[model samples]
Target: MTDKPLGRSAVYTVLTTGYTTSTGPGVAATVSYVSDRDRHVIVDPGMVAHRDRILGPLAELGLGPDDITDVVLSHHHPDNTMNVGLFPEAWVHDHKAEYRNDQWTDRDAEGHQLTESLRLIRTPGHSPEDITLLAGTADGVVAFAGDLWWRPDGPAEDPVAPDRDDLRTSRLRVVAAADVIVPGHGGAFPAGEGVPL
Candidate 1:
């Protein structure tokens, strides 16, 4: 009920700025690293030009795959989930559950708090199982919205959305809650720029 962030020190870094081609075969999911309290979270460790595109930056940050505590997937698309095996030790979070080695704990992503400042919100429509990771930082809330948009300039409409209304509603919710948005396939942008109304 408060507009204030949870007052925890959360830091986020976009390890790889992703891209998608209009003409041919090239794409990479934008990946991010968030650290809050005891949690080292990776958002969308998906397809990249190379594994080093993901691991190299992580190495630069002094973290190995073993150091990660959680991996959050916005949805199940292969492009957004290919490199998940890189972090074998982290619990994987999706819209409906958390998975680790041999465990699958079912839980709703809505309002699922991973840390004081990091939480999950169900934002279906990019896919029915889509979820967004909200990280509360000193600047404001940062919404890691996978395919909810391919980029800052949204597709205007998601061609493959099962429910366009749901996609729009989800987008509005994210726009309302986040000061910055890191799209699934592009660099982060301020919430106000070319956001779908």
Candidate 2:
């Protein structure tokens, strides 16, 4: 993979399942990912519902499960990691602080260092397994905050997020570290020295 700039390459919001179908906005799962050469890395595989809609965007980018090199899970919650089992071939990455061993390979850091262009950060709040992937090409920091933050209002924003305390500490990490934040289900949030959000 040649050295390149890192930014959001994908996102998938699927309908919720179980009792969630009755109340609250539908759940969403985002794929904060990037590609290098032919290999790809994905973060948080939302829900199994509307599978085609979930994976279709990637297909448009000419990506498939076989092309993925790593699958990083931000948390073990059903909405964020339910689809992980589908990618047995990819190296599954997640924070052991929250998730348990299963079919995918695991890691403790927030962003696993795949190359000089990548690094994962353990920004727990949304879940014990909560993590934020940062991309900086020996230059700057780009944050991918999984459920650690999200859109305030959306019909499909099922944020059964962990207590705000986790979200709070996680936000602290974001403030201390991130440059540009790609929140799970919201518009982009720029991280900086401004007053806390």
Candidate 3:
């Protein structure tokens, strides 16, 4: 798994699993970002190998269970939300229409924060929770697409107009205008396929 920080925001994402695995070609990550002063956020904290063997990376990051600022889950997949409870102080954020949002408040009791991160892209072919996150960062505007669009080896794999036809519409209404794309599992990509965003 790869671990690195994005820019200078203290927002760190460590690859917990990868498509490189012999079992499959899907990548998973444990996403953490600092929301405010001394407040850190975590997302999709999972195990790298045996599912039972979790809770090590958090310590490696010098973070304790109660140090997390929030837990922003992209969807309901266990690979992304399994170790959520390990951080007792985190306020969990996710789509309410699709996933249970109240669980975080009850679990943490410090209140929870919600975001449009799951922008209702409606990319159903991937999954009901296959959504994305649109937020402004120090770098610039971006869309954190969970699995809406992916990079193909060539343009053949590139998402064409209305590429999300598999789930519902013959095409996506509009992808959020942004500078970059922080996909859920894959590495970030130039937004608009490298247009002047």
Candidate 4:
């Protein structure tokens, strides 16, 4: 629902859908976009229900579905990969273990280097197929940590994350390397000293 600049890349988040638990209605998932002049990548494009939410933003940037060079899915979760059909022209990629259908053209074991400055790291914890995109920017390294840990009000353990050990390892790695982090759900935040969240 908002867009902002992160180092050399312009990043944005689009709310996809909502669900109701016993408590009340809550957000289901969010899709994030990161682009530069040459490449436009959609990370976890969310469910089909919010397809327009994805399209509208791209249109604003003077890009169509065909303009997206890469459609990167962090994992195989439906809330993340359900809209893969929308970007047929782009090279769809995910972890090798998570590729469900023939739609994915490339799969990486360690990680894939999308650009000289952007690299995807396999940080499996939230899901066996999870990956994180690290972009070397003018400011510092920016990490697109997908479902590794949900943003909480402060530095607290993610109660809902399935694998605590993997999550901790991934989080510590990101925190050490990244100056800015665009999480799978929440707004971008600064990491390292002074900023604790």
Best by TM-score: 1
Tens digits of per-residue lDDT, candidate 2, 20-137, equal 2322367656555565444477777766457665467667777676776777776667777777765556777677632323553444674456665566777766566677766663
Supply candidate 4's per-residue lDDT for 34.
64
The sequence of per-residue lDDT tens digits that candidate 3 reaches over residues 68-180 is: 76666656666556677776666566554322335523232111223322122333334454444444456654554444443211122333223334533311322334465
> In terms of TM-score, which candidate is stronger, 1 or 4?
1
The C-alpha RMSD in Å for every predicted model, in order, reads 1.6, 6.5, 8.2, 5.7
Off by over 4 Å in 3: 1-27, 30-34, 37-39, 50-62, 97-125, 149-163, 166-175, 194-197
Q: Count backbone clashes in candidate 2.
A: 9
Please give, for residues 35-148, the per-residue lDDT of candidate 1 as tens digits. 999999999999999999999999999999999999999999988999999999999999989999999999999988998899899899889999999999988899999999
Candidates in order, TM-scores: namely 0.95, 0.69, 0.56, 0.76
- Give the range of the ten consecutive residues with the poorest summed lDDT in model 2: 13-22
The all-Cα superposition gives candidate 2 an RMSD in Å to the true structure of 6.5
Q: Could you give the candidate ranking by TM-score, starting with the highest?
A: 1, 4, 2, 3
lDDT of the candidates, in the order given: 0.90, 0.58, 0.43, 0.63
Q: Which residue pairs show collisions in model 1? A: none
Q: How do these models rank on lDDT, best leading?
A: 1, 4, 2, 3
The digit string of per-residue lDDT tens for model 4 on 1-197 reads: 11112335444333332221211134344566666557677787765445687788678778888887877787777766777777767777677633323653455735567665666777777777788777767666777776664442323455555777877777777777777776665556787765332
